[model samples]
Target: MDLDLAQVRAFVLAAEESHFGRAAEALSISQQALSKRIARLEAGLGTALFRRTGHGVEPTGAGDRFLEPARRALAAADRAVAAALDERRPPRVDVWGHLYAPMRTLAQVAAGSGAPPLELGHGRDLPSVAAALLRGDIDAAFGRVHPPLPAGLTHRLVRLEPVDAVLSADHPLADEPALRPGQLRDSVLWTPAALHRLDFLHRFAERFGIRHHAEGTNLGLDGFLADVAADPRRFSLMPADVPLPDDPGIRSVPLVEPTPLYAWSLLWCGGNPRVDALLGALAAEAGRSRWLEYDPAEDWLPEPAGEPA
Candidate 1:
């Protein structure tokens, strides 16, 4: 028998909440509508699924038996929708955080190498990019990653970048040649939530007692720097490789102390012959480049998990 997914989801929620009012609120529907949906579902299955109690509603014996299966069905429906959406999208490589390095690699590869040209675009932060790669929303991406990737992904080392700070041009420290990690003990720093939430950022800030404001601010990159320029009380860190905007009001300063390096990687899904060739060519180029410091001899590089469908 064909089952209605919405009704099944409603049934599961009502059973779990054990109160029609609470269940409807959770589902963002009225209690009367929730009652009707449950009633329709119960009638379809020829059972009395709930009993009105003094305090609320209690699931019947049959309702208890059906709840687990209903939840499973709802989950299966969600997966089906996601899969269908992925299939409809075109293939592209997504840049999770910074686009400069990865774009440079791909551009060089497209120029001299016989590898297929790649279309690149911006993807979200770490975990979100991870999800999109697995879901087939993008064929590959570049971002900072440490250690083993997800079950269906692999990474190639790009470069290890030094920690640097961004400060307003008018700030007292802007004219300094370089920065040390501990010089900001009583200072205020601002970084987007995504960047500052990294374990490395948290640990480094805590050691020096640096007060950080991680607002994931609405101000775009230029606006963010402009705000920093207006307020000498703020500062933020970046990897030496991260491209800095040429705003006269702001400056990029390298943090000479070398503990928390930004490890960038080229992340990809498995088994596209063209993409695999492209990755091989790109890796070869990186190994030869002076700035990248890649080593083809390193046994640490992991292969793609398995062929992408």
Candidate 2:
């Protein structure tokens, strides 16, 4: 049966007021119109919803049963209208990343602006995070640089970092002030997905042709270090400034030959609310920091040049 909000309101008001004139007045409709609406509602429901009385109207059993459902329907309609109104403009987007220095910088940049609140997604690496972005699950990702970016995505490199090879402190190479790929040839490797820097590993492999055996396909932070501790010959290459436990048995050495570097970047699909606001915030911070877009050959600093003194 068909019934409108107006009919439901008429039913409610008429039931509450008991007097046709007062109910019609409260509903801003003529008494005749109110009565007709109630009659139409009763006919549609095929139930006598109210009993007329000398004092006021009272709901019949059916009317009492329908009251809560009607109220719920009305409330749901109200929420739908509000949500639609809020979505009248562009759709809000979600931004995601690991809480690292560069990402923290991006967050600060985005947060500093008084724009729509940036919704942040938590993840450890770029690919999984970027996968979500590409699947339309997220609007933007701020983590390790995304490569071979899918169509319809734009990636902008905000910063670049030289890398260091992490090894057990007791290892012989760790004692060397600084070493290169050749020196690490026989070392077993323990790279984590969260490390998210593929190019560096490839470059190291290309230069020295080191097997760099992986202890486990995917290992957590503690597991990774534990595996390395178990075998002192294992080493992992990671970003230069990222903090690691100061374990006496672990060491991080600067790799020299295929000295690797990775870009810090922001990636997004066009025209999403989250993407626009986040990109704007990132751009603003980039401006204030005088941060230049990364250009591998030209922008990358030599081994120690850009590293902290």
Which candidate number has the best lDDT?
A: 1
Error of 2 at 302 (Å): 15
Worst 10 residues of 2 by lDDT: 300-309
Q: What is the lDDT of candidate 2?
A: 0.62
**lDDT of each residue in 64-120, candidate 2, tens digit only:** 887655644544454455466775443233334322345445455655754446556
Assess the local accuracy of residue 131 in candidate 1 as a C-alpha lDDT between 0 and 100: 60
What are the runs in model 1 whose C-alpha is more than 4 Å off? 1-91, 98-112, 146-149, 194-200, 207-209, 214-218, 241-243, 291-309
Every candidate's lDDT: 0.64, 0.62
lDDT of 1: 0.64
Residue 117's lDDT within candidate 1 is 60
Pairs of colliding residues, candidate 2: 18-57, 93-274, 169-249
